[model samples]
Target chain A: MRDDEEMGRITLAQVAQKAGVSISTVSKVLNGRQDVAPPTRIKVERLLETHAYRRTARSSREAPLIEIVFHELDSIWALELIRGVENVAKANQASVVLTESGTRHSPDPDWIEGVLQRRPIGVVLVFSALPQAVKQQLRARSIPFVIIDPAGDPDPDVPSVGSANWTGGLAATRHLIELGHRRIGIITGPEDMLCSLARLDGYRSAMSMAGLETAPELIRFGDFHVEGGYDRAMEMLSLPERPTAVFAGSDLQALGVLEAARVNGLRVPHDLSVVGYDDVQVARWSSPALTTVHQPLRQMAEEAAQMLLRLRTEEPSSTRLELATSLVVRKSTAPPRAD
Target chain B: MRDDEEMGRITLAQVAQKAGVSISTVSKVLNGRQDVAPPTRIKVERLLETHAYRRTARSSREAPLIEIVFHELDSIWALELIRGVENVAKANQASVVLTESGTRHSPDPDWIEGVLQRRPIGVVLVFSALPQAVKQQLRARSIPFVIIDPAGDPDPDVPSVGSANWTGGLAATRHLIELGHRRIGIITGPEDMLCSLARLDGYRSAMSMAGLETAPELIRFGDFHVEGGYDRAMEMLSLPERPTAVFAGSDLQALGVLEAARVNGLRVPHDLSVVGYDDVQVARWSSPALTTVHQPLRQMAEEAAQMLLRLRTEEPSSTRLELATSLVVRKSTAPPRAD
Candidate 1:
């Protein structure tokens, strides 16, 4: 299975001729050499993409590596994802290369150069979208990649692993409803994220299914942070007819809700019940603990890494895999107080 | 300078000759090939160690990697330290290789083999002690290593980075004392670790300086976890003469203390002031935040990684560098009631 012959597509020689460059020059551009002229590099790159050239599988002597890239390494989800990838890498006798680069949508352009030079076994990205040029470059080198898209937005052609945000939202709302609460408030995440919208929709569906009228004032958008949760919860708590319970969207936001409840002289699970999303470590450490939706973030990372390995060997069974989310009952939620 | 030509040290040829093996076999053993016979490998290893054999520095074309190994990846400290090394790696155009391998004192034998093959620019270990054999293996490969020892126990000869544990403890206790906490309980970390002893000594010194009688019943040893804090705090709160405040040795333990106070129907700060150590992210996320000591974990990691880079080019000025710790006043501590 040689790379140049497998697809029966136009070979590198034809692409080199089309781009008016020597085969060696085309090879230099493919290998990410800095000596190639910028215009010639661009032309060769276009031809490679057009021809869908795939390099042969790397030799066995190459250093075994699995690269994981994240836009924001400070997120609480980072450790779990890293651990998951590390586990698989160890099992395969591969080292894990970590990089915090680029914006939320994709990794920085410079990052691709390092990956090309390293010639890692595969890459696992924690972003929702990747630019076409980046995708083309990775494909041209036969370096497989999979996205761990927690944001619930995935490109149709890309392989991705995500959790069921909508079901999580529904499960959380239903738990509160079952606890005899009718005036329910929700502080969903940022409006731009698809996962946030999905969760919000799930909350609305749950409320409507239970024959409860959701007031527009009870619905608010948060930034998935403690301060955002605090501000939104404070506003909702100050209402003339405050809700008995609130869904704080994320664990950080729920922590803010707990503080807001404390500021208003309300004890958790006694005066007001609160539910959180993403059962991160803090969920268990919070003073009263927290009743949250358990998103399989670590498992998602493992699956994404596994998908990359599978892509290296053969075609994957599916382009997208969505794991289920479940509700965890902790001390934070209970029946509303009878006043 | 070439490795064999430097320092007038014994060369690989001498090592292999003494071990009664071929030069190629000794080279295979150095590169971590698994095909060598166990007896032959052991003999070759001993010869190399006795001679202090060092290989040539890796070629410039080799993959740019900086390795960081941890025995436990779940600690709250992991994220910050990873970020620190990642920051430096990015600036230097190098990628970080992360591994969760080995025990509390040293990495597993299998880990060094991969590190050898990867030929990282250097390694940053998060353990208190490493075996002589592992150290020799790394040195022979010319792979510089530095320890990020928060444990406060470090090998005198190895370059290491650590923070001031004793000072951190003293600062935390002094802050509580200044807030009118005369009878302060202290729950330091596990007894076996030097850091635990140092912090406890600091607490004792602070109490003695303040002319306060250190009650034997008020002092305890914890496991640096939330549950240990909760258990110890619960016991203290149940005492016939409970202290007005408690010094939780770690933020995780401090979280435990807060929960224990809640279970006992005591209000934090108002009824019993609390102070925590190692102001990790959870310290700020905890409700009412936490009045704790900032351990500078990220900075320590950065310094350790930088030390490795320095060792690669030239000798480090010092074998050990200890950063200072300071108290952060949050909402967790306040003056006790005059009742």
Candidate 2:
């Protein structure tokens, strides 16, 4: 029994060394990353199974369970996204592990290492803007995974899931436009984020569609947080020719916009029309109820979890899933009048 | 090299078997959990060191990491509580592992086993109404843990951290009394929770202090959710002798109160005053900012994490730490008007 236990505990590095492949290739095989060649992948996988095969905590004797790795970046928005993911994981009986990629000051590598060492059937990368080099490392290891909101370009073969961010942005802009607002302003997330760019594109597209010129002064940047939104809104509202309508990239930012409006004695929809994206729970409860675009957060999370599960099970990857978005017309938005 | 690798991998289970002790005793020795006799504990520790026994992951190499297990009871309010815990855990350089305790229908023991096998330095239980038998099991294992908003009495030695619920209730009720409100209502959380009981006690105490009679019709039962708060608030307001002020146990519930007020055409602080507990982020942003008892959520989480860390480190367990609470005067509360 002791000998069996000792021999059964094979580290991935040892398997990689013995197979005359990079640790990544061995990882790719173990993770069922489909980019690898069939013969080489099979050989490595066979070796892995023979050496350290262990069923996942959720899996039956035959089926392997994928693990969803949630890296919460200090945001309450992550919680809603997690609920969406957990709902899907529970339905599928796949195991999910939640961890925080420590705050910006001290980025610990232990979280990543722990997930890798666990050798989960597959992984779902949730809200991780992992550096390119780290992403490359993960790819090289051929860790079967799908990025929900990855910082980099999506792999052609690996499945990815996200909302129709650009459309949502356009919808938010159009809502203000339909309210007869020409002098519309926009507050967006960090410029580096893909969603931020996509949302901005949507806003510009909507403005152009209305034959309205974009006002350079009306645009501002926020870090996709309530405080960031609040500060940026303050800056925008303080301008000489303040915008009549404000489009915020997130609901939290919209709240900030509301606060800024209140501080400036601007009545919502009466003095300032505001539209927000990601219509999180706060949107419905906030006073004047935020007019916003609803990101199919739950659907996106569920699809991503399913995609990761398929990858872990060595099933064929599905095409990228782009969920739809819709505008939830609420009291926060109104037509701009000649005040 | 293979033989050396094999020789170095000695699981604690092996050490426990060899030393003729329970896995709990071996774990206690490894983690320095001090309930065990000094001699037996030292014997196990010596065996582990002599054999060069290593924990499965490198997590063991670092100072013990604590886990804040969120017993997700399908309540959104838990999200803010988690945020509080995460903030503290991050500040302390301790990693938090989030796990969903099964709901009423799916009670699985595997969740507990998974956390235990990981050998977390300690655990911070949040809002989990764990059964007494399970608590006994945890106690028997001698795992150092702290329960936050626990549903039942924890082992005497295991420390707990929570807000001053009784005081919060009193503060809310007194705020109403000062407003010349004779008929005030209360919306409470689940009957089984200790916090709910404390909050009820405070409300009763405040009414007694004010020489005001408690109206049976004014008290309503809620599940500490927005919908529950909303329904209960509606019920209270519909009464012939309606309450002039309503104190809710949670912010989510308070939101429901606001909705109820809106539906009933009641102007806040004009016709009805509302006070809520645990001033979550939404409380500040709500239309008429909520007048709430600010439960030091972040501080409570930090204190709980600190307590768990101390317990895991073989330090003497301190008696329960009761964090302070304060009443945040906001737009939601005001003096009751004479009809």
Candidate 3:
């Protein structure tokens, strides 16, 4: 499928002809003009919402603008992605326009309508679940989209960029195990997120390899934010036989666990050990420095941008690109104290 | 100046007339269509780049998008501002479109052109120096823009939102003074930044009020970032007779000072006291937490958004808004120990 035909183009003339109205009436309805009759307006409005109207004919003079959609925009994690995308955009002479869905995992119903109106050359979605309906709408308009760290199991046909989350999770747990830790706990991201499930599976794989039963009580689902980590860590720490080491799904969550420990008077490494994912700057800035899995977030974003650019230029490329993750040893993890 | 006239709407016909070509020839040039004479194409393209062609008649059918431009998108500091703007935007049924200047303090020269092409209802600039030419262009297009924490001395005519940095700086320095530290070192933001200068002035005022001579060698200009704090603190700590306390320009800077102390094997509060500005979350997560000034970044952002919205409605309002900052005493400060 070529880029421009993704959302099968809907022309105003066609819409007007189908609605039995003049082009001016259709235009008025589109412009939200008050002069259109209510019934004609409703008919035109529904068509606009349900279909994409291509404006390329009159918009030939505008520069290529790329639209990046985020499930939410409140994260330091986004800074890396923005940097990578902006780097690519500048080199290509394209300007980026950012939109937030406001939801954590999906966009509002009319997001496609707004996106199509702008006629962006390409789109990048971060931590999102692209519903089939939206996907169909995008495909119909020929607007190629690439997902970065998609939140759920993405459709096989979709293009995406991600980190080796399972490997990262495995390495994190294995490091703790090598440090002579057992009874390890894991804080994973939202249950529906594929990366979260992959990380948890890796943890379970590590535990199974060590001949330890996977204890349900030691596993907690988190939102990959500080508060989520804090709340879950608080619960696990209250258990009669709490784990001596914890593997957090993300660095932010890891910081939360550290705070929970502090509140409970447990010194890191001295009384407990902790590991986190993402290895964001905060992980290094943590007092003890955090031992975390570096997800190459910026690299992933660059790759996503490159992939989208290739799609725009009609170059052949792989649909999915999963970058490697590596373990960064700082000071947050150590052997558990003698019992 | 009314919003929408900032770019002074131009049309394809106008470009064609100016280029001495047929309207079709200009339209082809705008669309990147081949077959036009090279010289004629160049003339038409130049006109298009320098002019604003109103797409509002066709774009009015699109949903409202408000543009938010940031000098750089590199820090978690932006999250608070994003949350605040997003909250208000949602309540008012408006969606935000974000852009970054890439330059640390100034927007790209062509930024306003792209923004006007998009026809956003309003714009909000964060830590930016809006050039006079751009301001005139925006005003002519009738586009309203409000600055949030302007990066430099904003033009008097521009509406802006800022924190009471002078007061915040005074409180930070005064707190250290009350803790019985006579020799105090200070770090401020970039040399050209208005906020940075105001903070340094505040520090000087506090020292003068305390009857302590402000030593030139003890002051350093910083960029309100971690690395800046680290390098400056390292130098201050190496002085033969170093000050007993340091006032960091920002929270990230304060963390850098902490790191510096760690490198020199100096225990915080016990050997050196520190105070920071901008009470971001990192301030609370630092080992001893951080004694810092709480700048109302989110509130300032909300206020900026409200101010822009008012401009979009052509309502009269104050041109400058300076919100108060307060001292947040945490664990990073203490009385100097007896030598």
Candidate 4:
């Protein structure tokens, strides 16, 4: 039993080396990415089955299972991630178990122990970090875990899946800039989160490139919800020199900003242009329809689940996977009106 | 060990019978629902713990755990339910384990078997049913389960938690009528769902009570989403004599109705009035802030979680728990005008 456990530690690199194919090629097949040639996909799949032969020798019929741990099921964001994970989970016949981390930035040791007891093939943590103690213990048990949008700085050992926040921020800011808006205000997420910092940095860079000075007062930090967006945008719009345009870090926040605009008697696209990030479900449903940056949260989550599965059953590949972002122009943005 | 296992199966009736208190009084203490006299509460709690003093003899340090099973993690609706369950789960020092039943409405035997293997204290099924075979297996093992908003007829054997949908529909339509609107249109959920039929029935009764002839063309069956709501409302509005007010079965559908109105250049509450159900997070944020029936989905979920915990550890209460719903009049409805 101990020897079989040792064999379970086989890495994705080792499988690729043995199969005489690149690690990426092996990953495409395992993730059901559909980009790989059929023959190569077949060969890689055969090798993966053989590699897990000992484990499946007991029973080939039962589907595999994985675990997804979230810090909180706070918003629509969580639903999008769950949808992505389910898409892949269904196709692979692998179940996803959800457990909340209960507001602690570092997970409770007892919760980690419970996960260890379940012995899921792999674990995916969303907007979460692994404390040193828990990380050491997970490694000792030979269980693979991946982080999605880590709360802190990226650690070399932890694999992660996230969208390009900086690029998204840059695109949103540039859209406002090109539309003849110079006095642009930005509402970013919590300062400590990596994605928040990246988005803030992206906004600063765009302002600098446009030869515009980013006023310190124009930037506000928020919790990425409607209330925070409304509060911060109220302050920005209340200033003696109100910005003609605003960029919000989340769709929820942008809706709040719109509320702020309505309360202040400012018309969207006619008096003020607004841009939101993370084109969540209600963005299109909102009146005037929000123009925003598209963050592929669902696809990113699917990739994360796929990555964790590979790490558990096959071998580890290159650690970080950053999905690209794009700008989606809708009815909410337009050129600032003449004074 | 076997003796302790047997003791674990001790029913709440057995506890109440020994404690010399009514089963309901004992239940109040077990669920921490305050109202019992201090002396009675203390006496019941003591007896409850002493009944299986041996169970605590093993270790009472670890918190108890419960399971919540969902049909699919597809919508904001699911997250609200999760949040409600988590609130009670946290207060009771009980952790929640979430499992998705996927496409199969009635869970597979294997899935039920896997849950049984986990040995959870109780289970909460959201919009799900158990096959007779699986139900028998669960009962034989003494594991308790409750259904929340069951999709089919209310089964006597299965305890369930839900809101008063008929009352909600009545309240919404009555609000429109009292606003001086004689002609009202209704859009309901899927035909097979009990809530759908109830809401539709409620609409018919309200129209009858008003001595108004019900128009078959004005009532439409929808899937309870934006697209369906929009399509049905569009159809109703295009009629030669359109209704002055529309009542949508869900907030999503209301948004669809709003979209239809916008496309047709009708101003809400001025040219027409709209009322929605479910009052999800986005309703308050929508343009004109939707008038809706508060379904209490989150509170209903909390009550369901609390009920499941009680069913497992205490004597079961009367089977079905129906929470009350109310109307939240926002900006979407008003008196009809004389053009």
Candidate 5:
């Protein structure tokens, strides 16, 4: 479907005529100018999408730029992703244009206009899902984009990069089980996220395989942030029979668990054991450091950027690339004390 | 001198003639084209510099881009600074171009070429100093730039924004002193950086003011990283008469100190008190949380970005702006336990 332009089957004039608009108006719409009325713009966009009109490769005279859009720039994961894209862009002698826009689902509507006008080599979106309209707009302009979907929910049509969440969860739980912890708790991400559910299922599988009971009271959902981890940990700690070990979903959440334990007068790895996912820099820098799942965020971003560059020249072999997640043994996890 | 171009005191043709180069050659140099010979490029550059040939204000037709160049994007402060610039750039409806280039002192020579062609609205550099040649090129092209100097080293001629390192040092020290800590040690940054010296001095002042002798063994210069903090802290903790509290000069260093104390079987704020500088995210995320100095890194970057915009329309009222730092008391510090 993306190759219709390779056959030279569509032209701007044809799209303009079909949309009942002037060639200049079509050009304006293509450039994302706001002057065009909504109706006309929608009509032109539909025509372009139907024809799959891919813009020609950018001229060499323009400085090569790669655009990376993030819904939330404040995320702890932002730096790793930016560095990944930056690494690839630098290697290609291209600069990175960063935009913080939109919700977790898609970029803001206004963002597309600037992107169209800039005519970057490609775009890398740190979003779980791309709005269909936005996807069509980018596809019509031949702006190849790949989503760095750390959330593990990949749209089948869009090329995406994610990590092995289930494997990460299985390994984390198995490590604790091997250390002779029978009653282990799991604090996964929001219930709505696929990664969280995947991790939870992995934990449940590990517990069942080890002949241990999966107690409902020992399972919880978290916001994947520090405060949420602390709150959930405190609740479990107050239980009459609290779990001896916990898998704290994300590194930020893991820090909260560490703090919660401190507040509860329990020493990490001695009175309680905590494991975090996402081996972000903070994982290593945390007080006792954290035993975490290495989600390969940077490598995932690098792969996404590389995939965008690849899509520009050739058809992708696969639309989804799920990298492996490994366990990192640090200071946070240990055997539960004898009664 | 910057107003010479506004007064139309120089022309490209005249500069080309003076340099004995063709107008086209001068134009290529202006565009940062690499085809020109070294001698010709330098000759044309000198003539342009002599005449103060500021390129006319960029055409509004071009995309408004704000460039931010960092020598090391891996620094923990990078995110805060990027957020600050991103905040301002978004407000102005300008996209941000991020470049990781050069060293701590200046950007690489090749970096200027792309900047020349991109012709961003302005540039915000995250470096302690800019080479004379790079400064000349930027000035000749009328591309205003401001440095975000967290290192506390500001070139006299360049507009820069920095924080009050000395004051931050004083605040952290006084917080410890007020907590009844008579014997305190400090782990400041590298000895060469002015900020490190300033912070060390602040610690010294606080100690002297409290009628305490500043022991040579208690003051240690560190690399301002976690490992450095850990090594120095271990050395200090091993002293015959160890400090009751330690002031770690940076958040990363403070993390190291926490680990060191843990290894020594000393509880934070109980067996030992610890205070950190730079209240970065990690400071708050650490097990006990760190009592530290709040360096307004994001604000400093915002000011630098704001300064660049102001430079486009008017001369800066002051070339150097130093934001204040304050103390943030958290869980890390307490009165020294009775020996």
Candidate 6:
């Protein structure tokens, strides 16, 4: 085979003549264009395998290519995750395609169908909630995929990779509690995301553990954005019983909180305390540097990519890997002042 | 032809028979796998084309995928650029493959070559200065590419999209001059990058315009990183004839300069006026908001993608597009205190 390492380019007519079929029938079967009958398709596939034709560099092959799709492109966190996927794919000599899913309210079914029809190796969905119909379609095709930070239902069988977001949330809340701040406010990400739910759960659990009463009025929903965080913080501060400490679901949100505090003439630590998540680069640079929960983003992304590659090569493993999270004690977190 | 689109598939034997060549010769010519006589190769190609036999997607139709290669994944600026590229790609219905072009000092050429062989639709080079051999290889294959912020000798023919970095530098320097700063210091990115040169040009242009002699000791080289900026600022501030205004090439570097100012008991604007570039999100959030040069990053990226797509479609056009840069006035810049 190495002698003719690249020499086996056979034409469809030769195969068709040998199989006693019209060139059109053979072409239809070989191209996998839907017009062909199943029997004809199978026959052509067998001939293809036996003859060992070389594929063009530009064409999609019988073997699928895995695609990793993300919702946001601006965040360093997303890029790190992508690096992880790339590392794994490189090791396996497999190519991974990346695309942005956009911020549309509904996932485009036509787009999903077109991608799947190309017979990708598998899909590593980044920050998308799979619709039931899409899931059903994938299931029918028996195409393997892994979801990262799915916004909706979590299928028990589908593999997923994420940080210990719940623990991260709990750690952030506990740090505030330990600072003797009873009036703590929370600014959270979109309610639809699983990470947001987990973070909320962690905050609740931490509050419960500290024997603190939950104040529904102290919590506000932000879209995990800087502006959202600022607006939410302003709302919290205007309350008659304001929170002395605030926990933001993301570092961007925390910065927003800081701005809100500044505009209100409140000094950090002396007037307010804050904690954030993801520990992105800006966390350490901002004034009164954000106290954040560090998610092992790079590690998690690498592991997810490796897991997807493994699933492609071996039988699907029944194991799920959850990376750890840690609290970075920065200036944003401090003891409450004696008012 | 539209109605009989399914009839385009034909076999190697038919092509070989029509071209009056052996099946092996036809295979070699089609696959470009082996050395074939030029006449025979051309004959086989014409025969295959005339018969309307389309290459199967499974057969090496060199995959039309394009790759976006970055030099460093950890840099926040790079991440933002990636986001811009992602947004544009999504709109164009194109897939982008991401890869790290390895480290800054010692890029892996072999890794890049292997990727090129995979036959992507095209490539968008981000942040890395590609090696000469790699550029030559791409040229040999006639692969269309677009580069962003290339450091090394970029191919003269490849389309490039970049911000007006030189003008940005001049604006920062001139802003300081307008505010009555006679002694000004500058922090710059890697010396090898064109941006570094452009920024230097801007600084000199502004200083000459202000009738201030370009002092040899006033300029420092930094890696366009926070730590580098901090270290350089500290050195410049401790001088006997310290500068009252410092212009940094990047927002992260500006933050570093601010930190150094704080440690040295110098107040921003009041004691030391600072101007930075790339009005990244952090510039506005910092305690004393940084006045910097704003690069229309989103537009630049979208334009870059459009350029690559045009090239991929074989549309010849200009090799470079220079986007505008504007100065964003903020608290970090102000008039120097008069003794």
Quote model 3's TM-score for chain B: 0.81
Rank order (by lDDT, best first): 5, 1, 3, 4, 6, 2
Q: Which candidate has the highest DockQ of all? A: 5
Scoring only the A-chain of each prediction against the true A-chain gives TM-scores of 0.94, 0.76, 0.81, 0.79, 0.96, 0.74
> Each predicted complex: what DockQ?
0.77, 0.18, 0.33, 0.19, 0.82, 0.27
| TM-scores of all candidate predictions against the true structure | 0.96, 0.71, 0.77, 0.74, 0.97, 0.77
lDDT of 4 at B320: 80
lDDT of 3 by residue, B85-157 (tens): 8767766756666677746655776575567566667888875566665665565455778888634365577
| Model 5 DockQ class | high
Per-residue lDDT of B1-339 in model 4, one digit per residue for the tens?
786686675666776787787888766554344477867756665565445422211124333557777777765478888778878876775666666674535654445645544455677777544566555545544567787773334656678888888888899988898898888999998887888888888888888898888899999999887889899999999999999999999898898898788778787878889999998888988877899999887887888887877765575544887888899999899999888
Better of 1 and 4 by DockQ: 1
Consecutive 10-residue window with the lowest summed lDDT within model 6 chain B: B54-63
Q: For residues B1-339, could you state the per-residue lDDT of candidate 5 as single tens digits? A: 556556557888998888888899999999998999988888888778767677877677556899999998889999899989989988988899999999999998888988998889889999987898898888777788998898999899889899999988888988888989888999999999999999999998888888889899999999999999999999999999988999999999999999999999898989888888888898888889899899999999899888988887895443889999999999999998876
Error of 4 at A94 (Å): 4.4
**What CAPRI class is candidate 1?**
medium
Give the best candidate by TM-score.
5
Please give, for every candidate in the order listed, the TM-score of chain B alone compared with the true chain B: 0.94, 0.76, 0.81, 0.80, 0.96, 0.76
Superposed model 5: Cα runs more than 4 Å off: A1-8, A316-318, B1-8, B316-318
Off by over 4 Å in 1: A1-6, A9-14, A37-39, A50-52, A316-318, B1-6, B9-11, B37-43, B46-54, B316-318
For candidate 6, write residues A1-339 as lDDT tens digits: 564446455677877876678888875554434576656655666665556543332243222356777666665467667777777766765656777664533245445644543456677776545665455445434456777652333456667776788888899999999889888888888887777888888999999999998799987788877888899999999999899999988888998888788678786767899998888788888766789999877777777776766765575654556778999998887889886
| Residue B51 lDDT, candidate 5, scale 0-100 | 71
Weakest ten-residue segment in model 5 chain B by summed lDDT: B1-10
Candidate 2 lDDT, tens digit per residue, B9-88? Answer: 56778888988998988876554344788678657766765565645443543333455556562355456556566666
- TM-score head-to-head 2 vs 3, winner: 3
